[model samples]
Target: MTDPDRERPAEADDEQPVDAEAFYEALDARGRPVVTAAEVAAALDRPAGVVDDALSGLESDGDVGRLDVRAAKTAWYAPGRADADERITVFEKRRDVIVDQPAQYTRALLTQFAHLENTNREGGYVYTVREEDVWNAPYATFPELVSTVRSALGGRYEAIEEWIEGQWERAHKFRLATHEDGYVVLEAKSADLLGNVAEPRLDDGVLRARMGDETAWVAEDRTAELKRTLYEAGYPVQDDRELETGDDLPFDLDLDLRPYQADWIARFADSGSGVLVGPPGSGKTVAALGVMADVEGETLVLVPSRELAGQWHEEILERTTLSPEQVGEYHGGAKEIRPVTIATYRIAGMDRHRSLFDSRKWGLIVFDEVHHIPSPVHRRSASLQTKHRLGLTATPVRETEDQEEIYTLVGPPIGTDWEALFEAGYVAEPEVEIRCLPWASPAHREEYAASDGHGRRQAAATNPAKIREISAILHENRGSKAIVFVEYIDQGDAIAEALSVPFISGETPHARRSRLFDRFRRGAVDTIVVSRVGDEGIDLPDAEVAIAASGLGGSRRQGAQRAGRTMRPVGKARMYVLATRGTEEEDFARNRTKHLAARGVRVRETEPVAVVDPEDASATPDGGGVGFEAER
Candidate 1:
């Protein structure tokens, strides 16, 4: 049998004579000794078969060597020019491929390169360093190899250090520790150094240098934020912050709950910490009590005011198995600390008494009107240790950026279905009327124009025309329960005196305020004027009407709270806001009503009605009224 690869054919006489030596010399002149059969044929102006025959003849004569460059392709090279088995070099080899000076590599620079490679995982390049030959890893190209080596030797050793530090970070454990000065420090275990492990902003001198072997420090109050960041970055964290636990005082409570209230309680039980947002009079207190019952341990309740604290105390006694002996009040002159304690934010946040509560263990801590918890003074309560935390509020928003702090401290907020509750008749359907009263008294208008921003606003908010409107509203709703919300104590007093009704303010004695609230609840007093103290966290379930004579400047929280004061379903409850037309009061009223307007409550406007001037007539203030024409 003949070998097909070795077969050769006879060349015709018309074909030009093949010059193997000249062909090899021409291929060498082109800077490559290897010549394919097709190139030989083209250079000789002959067919490929003819060139193949000549190459076979030359190979038989042992003057030229054949090499298989690839499948079905042959190359003729001088015997010593190249080797067939050698691997191709994609880049040039240089003596400086390995960096000599280690200090030239920086962690940040290496991290930059590593991040580039890491971000493109499918690029077939390895940027991570290994323990062996980690610094001298192979490069994909000659230029890149030269550039990387030169950078490593050019006083940038931190690059290599950063890569190694990342490796250490992935395997180490981190923890938090509080310093005596109230600052927090981060410490690491099994870490040789803390090179670029955390953000540079946290690298104060105290922890940066000493982090050489198994310890690092940050001198900021944002330890919680830092912990989250580090944990997300693939660092193992062992949280060391102290958490206090109260005595397990279990109890059973017998009470009926609405479906949504029970659902919120179940959610609280699962998470152990969260904010419950519901409309006013939606039984947030009942849900909180249900959480307390489920927790079955010592509970501490925080409120925004003394009145709210008293309300919480009363609710705990009325609704829970815990008696008055188990509950205690921590506001004002009383500093009792029982299994179930109710304290105002002012009392709980007091530096002198903060330690008393901070040191004790609490199973549950309930924050009423939790929106106030974002304030700097009130935020201190966030650090208190409790197994379960519940924040209850009718209005969970604030007009400030501190609103985010509430979520960070407590947990994510879960809100009740306001529309669902309203449809189910669990809450009132508000009929809001915006009475655009004309600014009364030329003296008042002149004073308002002459005053600065604050004084001007006060003048418009307290215009005598608003008093006339309030009087009309009171008379329109006569013989029914009503609460008038005033911005100032003097304004509440004036309204109460003119209408011959009771009034309450911050300075009103606790006993007298309680009695007044009771009288208003019953039919003894048809109306009562209260200051901003009644805007939030006070239960006035039976009042069918709320009159807003004055309010804070453009505060949605104040507006929502005031509207919520009459949110108890009582046969189409009404909220009457009296604002002077074309003044700052109108602007403020618009700002306040925006939140309510979003919830499908239209503020119907009413033209001012003419009435007998109280100063000139002997007519009763409640009866000398104006009729309203609802205008959307």
Candidate 2:
């Protein structure tokens, strides 16, 4: 069949302009290609001048392009010629593609695909790698392949055979060199696959496809066609277009989730068990609660701090299907306890009566910030044995080695990075602007440089000038409702006093801290400075900003929690790290980020604080930890 003409004339048997359908019909009437205005007018029973005007309109709308124009003659049409296949488009035109898909077997597929690509280059066929193709596998594991194909290929398993046949006929003969249970190894010649008779040649690390055994290269426009063909054939997964918005949320919370949040939840719920790792405030609590709504029986949620336990209680009551009767809290100052409980990791980790050693049955146990599970006591308690487990944390484990151990104990990583959620508007996009306080300032930098080890971090963090700078920033953004994070109670007290904001430290009374968080969430107060106790699973949905004035230690869990405080997706949020120019405070801040590489958290220079409109009362865009640290 010849290509369908895709053009419309200015006028076709009408006093008014022809509609889009009529224009398409006119093109269909012209079997070969677009005709001259005179020819179109004759065919449409209209005057040549009217046809010319209509073609001009079509050209303006990108429906057609004019090839030539003259006084009494004119020709215009769509730019590209029709190919045999209309369902072809480009993939990852000019971007680098990472091989991360089907999360279950990403590494397995990467290994196989890379090996095949390297070994299969001997034949005449050429291979054109699209950015998105970086994530495909041989689909050797038929069952898993069937599931992925059904979801990705519009539930059309029948098309798989046809696509394979077409690819085989078009390309050099291909074979799965190694086909096993869940893995398949493939090798194919590019010439055979692409249906090009050109001999493939490598020039400067790029493989070029020749046309008709000639030296001429295929036009760049043809790349998309080739890519779309392979894409429909199920060679790879598409880039995530929807945000992780927690779409499969079991029970609808009175909240609107961003796309990334939905996606994250879906991935986890589908996987049944794994880690949901991202920077803090990425809505780990909300995500955990969402999962609890779907799971059968009671869920026990373990947090790291009392502040977090209380925060979880409030959020559970506010956002989950669980009733106060069903949900329980096992913490100090708790009046009632129920089946679906929220308990502190420290308390749960403690060997109160060595009861943890006994096998206790639970429908589901959620470890909020499960990275803390690696602690000797927590690990021992957690090792008490439970099959169904969910590790919810902004950062999971500290580094690769820890991740390996965590994987053996917990499960593989399930959720995508925080940036995925951030860019999709699931979480706010942070606007980062660096204000490099002068390192030459002798008062702070000099003292910090002279101190040794931990003292240096303390010196840098407590420097009068640096403190004043943070205090000023806090004062300026005071209306946005912020949290000042400090490493020690003394620092929290000092910073709180300096900024004149209410303080909650480890020593803060349970009832008082609960009241303080309540006041912060209600907008009755603006800022609350706290020690590390506030870093873990606490829910401060109203707080959109966090200031890390100190606590720049290498505790990946702490770093993740501090950043997470501002990532809650409650509205928009921003996290500010106040470092003393060039001090251990900065170095410690760097150490705090070591755990995020695997989880894909990119820690960089501080992002700009967003202006909070009192009328809106939403959090500002909290710059997610992605990309890399900026040079400050």
Q: Best lDDT goes to which candidate?
A: 1
Instruction: State the lDDT at 552 in candidate 2.
Output: 72
Q: What's each prediction's TM-score?
A: 0.62, 0.54
lDDT of 1 by residue, 296-356 (tens): 8898999877777887787778887887899999989588999999988888888999998
Q: Residue by residue across 1-632, what tens digits does model 2's lDDT show?
A: 65434355443355766434455555557643444565566567776677777778878888776643111123444456431211122122321113211121211212211211211112111123322222222222334433432322222435443443343343223222212332222234453543342222212212233333212232322322222333334332111111111112234466666555576567666545566665555666667666666565456677777677776777878875656676667766563435666777666666673364233445567877677666565665454333356787655546433333343345435554343455344565443222334332334455666778778767766644445556556655556777777877777776677667788977888789889988988888888888876876567765667777777764756765666666655665666666656555655555554433223233356433322121222311221111112222
Off by over 4 Å in 1: 1-198, 201-244, 552-554, 609-632
TM-score of model 2 vs. true structure? 0.54
Candidate lDDT values, in order: 0.64, 0.50
Clashes of each: 14, 44
The 10 consecutive residues of candidate 1 with the worst lDDT sum are 95-104
